[model samples]
Target: DIRDPARPKRLSAVADSNFSFWHSASFNNDGTKMLFTDEWGGGTQPRCRATDKPEWGADAIFTLTNDQMTFRGYYKLPAPQTSQENCVAHNGSLIPVPGRDIMAQGWYQGGVSVFEFTDPARPREIAYFDRGPIDATKMYVGGSWSAYWYNGYIYSSEIARGLDVFELLPGGLLSQNEIDAAKLVHFNELNVQDQQKLVWPASLVVARAFVDQLERSSGLTTDRISAVRQSLTAAEQASGMARRNALTQLATQLESEAGGSSDGAKVRMLASEVREIANVAR
Candidate 1:
């Protein structure tokens, strides 16, 4: 906690009793929560082996309250790493996703991991990228140093491989709407230590992305996807309040039948977004 630019003071510190070594940390946008990583066996140690404890080289999420931090849980790379690889949490940063707590982090030879930690105790990876190790035969002290989310893109600085850039695609555990919404968030200035708060606005593009997500996830059948696209197109092409009402009605029907699909909740959410878009058009 550096309150003064020149004179930085430590408010509180956790000891080795809590873990082994403190590597890096990231706080939520509000600064109400903190996530710290444990460098158990150092960067060159393979703490990600099958026999390694999850807490040894993992991220520990803490809920901060009135100068006190409460340990929430741990988030480790689920993938097993070789004893030769430097598999431990290094550095990471938060991705602004409204009320959700999502982060993209770096793990030496473990690779870069993008995950959600809305429920600190139940963090899960959504997207990741990893290539063959520095050398398949041997693992030296070379891997990603930091993986952070800046603006709408993810940047990774490797020790030996140089810089790596990635664009998070909408798939797996995320939807197009979610990705689009996340991209909408921007920062004029970003300092890793001085994290900024994020706010997102609702818009038509977000609604379209939701519909796209539904289609991509197969949440709706091909016929249903086509019908939904046609309806949205017609609503867009139509004129007057009549068109608005028509779109609203279609959205209402979709919302009402949301329970019928495997992704019912998502369908309901998309329907509501469509309805909101219709209202905006009106």
Candidate 2:
């Protein structure tokens, strides 16, 4: 705890045999989990080739409890890079997707990768952007040095190519609703290393995002999912007291359904969001 700047207390420290050099660290939105990157080759060696071990030069996920950290798992770029590309974990920042633990990280000469570690033990990549090595036949250190999610887009700082901006497209893994919901979060200033807590506004889009998650997890029945879609559509079309009434009704129904839902916590959250939206409806 850093409550006292004059005398900062050390919580805990950990190490892994697979990790060569600890480069940087970041926390999840709630700080319940932390991720550390391993700069195995110090950003100047081919550490992501087919023969390279996945555990080396990868990301380590850990869960934090009462300021103490415990190792959970590791995550590395799945695609193998050529020997000519000097690649290893670099820098990244959390993507505010609400209720999920996701990040956009950069790898030297390996490009940018967006992945989720909600499970911690089994982190998986959802999207990525990469370019071939600056020189196909020779190793030239040139790739994303840092990739951070700010506002609604990912801004990457390339070593030799300058800046690159990326937008998440709708796909099987990530829905447009989830992307839209993520865009709702805004930050005036961000320091990826400092790690900030993410707070999403209570809006219909957020509620819909939750519904989409429920569908993905099979947390809600198909009939209930369709009903929610129709109700949200109806509420959006209405105005004034009509919209408020519709949303209020839907929120109440959702709250009642939570008792039987497999993901009751998420259902309650969705209900709370809808209730807040109803309150703000003019």
Candidate 3:
């Protein structure tokens, strides 16, 4: 612990049987979980071919609690690469999507992948970009070395090619509002090695994003979801106290219903965000 930097103290440490080279690691926005990436081949060997085990050269997830960590599971690139590609986990950063633990990371020659580990035991890929190996018949150490999300877009540092940028598009797994909400979280500077706690501003986009999450999870009834959307729309169209009053009313209603909702925590978060929006509305 760095409680006293003059003399550092070690809290706890654990080992996993699957890890080879502990290349890098990162924590979720809330610090409740941590992810460690294994670079088995040092980014110069073919470690992501069909013959490789998924647990090798993969991300090992662990849950953090009371300064203790417990292994949860492992996540690797779902698609196998050819023996010609030098692929292994490298560097990555979190995508600040509220209420979800999403990440965008690079594999040596596996390109870049954006995935979610909200349920640490069952991580899943949400989006990815991959190219054929540099040489189809021979191994090549040319692919993304780092993939990080900054501002509203993802930037990948390609080892062979130059820098690559990406704009996240709305799809079945993620929505436009969620994207917008993520965009609201801006940083003057970012260091992938040092994880930061992401926070979204009190904006209509963020409130709506929370609502969308509730709808996606069926956290609220269809009628209630529809009504909340309608209210938000109306508030957006109104001005002055009219807007504030509408949001305030809706937030109060949400607060009252959250206890009975399936996703009570999310509903309460929605309520709190909406209430904050009402506070700043003009």
* Top candidate (TM-score): 3
* C-alpha lDDT of all candidate models, in order: 0.79, 0.91, 0.91
- In terms of lDDT, model 3 sits at 0.91
Model 1, 146-245: lDDT tens digits are 8988888989998888999998887757766677787888888777766776765555556666667676568888898888878877777886797789
Candidate 3, residue 219: the lDDT equals 99
- The per-candidate count of clashes, in order, stands at 0, 0, 1
Model 3's TM-score against the true structure: 0.96
lDDT of 2 by residue, 94-152 (tens): 88876789899999789999999999999999999988899998878789999999999
TM-score (C-alpha, index-matched) for candidate 1: 0.71
**TM-score of every prediction relative to native:** 0.71, 0.95, 0.96
RMSD from true fold, candidate 1? 5.4
Alpha-carbon lDDT of model 1: 0.79
What are the runs in model 2 whose C-alpha is more than 4 Å off?
Answer: none
